[model samples]
Target: MTRSVALFATCLGDQLWPEVVEATVAVLERAGCRVTFDPAQTCCAQPAFNSGYHDEAKAVARAFVEVFERADAVVAPSGSCTAMVHRYPELFRDEPDWRARAEAVAHKAFELSAFLVRELGVVDLGARLSARVAWHDACHALRELGVHDEPRRLLRAVAGLELVELRTGESCCGFGGTFAVKFPELSTAMLDHKLSGLDDRVDVLSAVDSSCLMQMRGRLQRQGSRVRAMHLAEILASR
Candidate 1:
């Protein structure tokens, strides 16, 4: 049976790394999913939620649940945004009615890697790519979703893909949505520490969140480093 999945392209995803969103659609189709995208869907409201704007965040998150509440399964290439969806129920604590809706939608929501490996029992995508790759934990994906091994399992199955372990693979890239904006200096410092582990052994740095990739990629480009930052979906969709 083909699972009909609603693709939740996070706000940053559609704007910054549109190619990654395209890659996600291609990958899900290969995994036997009938993918649907609702352009009416908007932000997950993570930035506002994280920045202590509960009322504004709730408004946006309410719209989000309204769009995806009917989905059989909603998958996003972003761990950060998916993590925010998991917290939607809490965002509507006082409203029992909306909270119930949020809970149902959150339960069906999944990060890309976890959906493929754990839910779908798919580890390999028959992808071919020759390059040394490192997986970044993308904070929310690791701590919130407990998605540590799923991405690695899928990447290891890719032919000619050398999955290397970075010394600080699990560290934050300092791109915590608005967290990077509020403290630019501290953010750059944390990002520098995160990228200090990169070397010639790894050509591509892949993570489940595009926000983290954008943060690191900007620093790498400014420093004239050839290290490429890619979303996990892009690598998985490769052939």
Candidate 2:
């Protein structure tokens, strides 16, 4: 049986890193899943939700629920956004019907790595990327979603890929959506601490969240470091 999966392209993944979405599609298709993309999809309203705009967040969450209610599974390349989708029920708590729909949608959604490993029982994708890469755990994916070992397991299965330990791999990249913008100095300080922990040995830094990759990549670029930041989907899609 071919599982039907919907691609929930987060705002960041759709705008800043379409390659991540493309890679996600590639990985899903390679896993024997039928993938669908909806043009009507927009932001998961994580920004509004995080910034204390509950009504606006609820509106967007309702749209998301309507858009992806039918897929057997909804997979996103971003962990933070997936985590946000899981909060739709909270956004629509006062309304029983909408809350039920939101809860159902949340139950169907999964981060790409989690869907592949947990749902499809797939560990190896025959991906080949020869580089000393360190995997950074996106905070929401690690703590909120409990997606610690799945990504590493998939990475380890990639042929010729060397998964190195980043000293600050578990630390936040300081890209808490609005949190970074509201407190720039603190965010930068946290980012600097993260960067300082990186040794001179890694060639690529990979994470499940594009937002984190963007935060760390900007700093690495400013410092002119050779380490490249990439999404795990892109890495896993490599053949």
State the lDDT at 175 in candidate 1. Answer: 83
TM-score of 2: 0.98
Clashing pairs in 2: none
- Candidate 2: tens digits of C-alpha lDDT, residues 11-45: 88898888889999999999999999999999899
Root mean square deviation (Cα) for candidate 1: 0.8
Model 1: residues >4 Å from true position, as ranges?
none
Model 1 scores worst on lDDT over the 10 consecutive residues at: 168-177
At residue 54, candidate 1 shows an lDDT of 99
Worst 10 residues of 2 by lDDT: 164-173
lDDT (10s digit) by residue, model 1, range 38-141: 99998999989989999999999999999999899999999889999999989999999999999999999999999999889999999989999987889999
List the candidate 2 regions with Cα displacement exceeding 4 Å: none
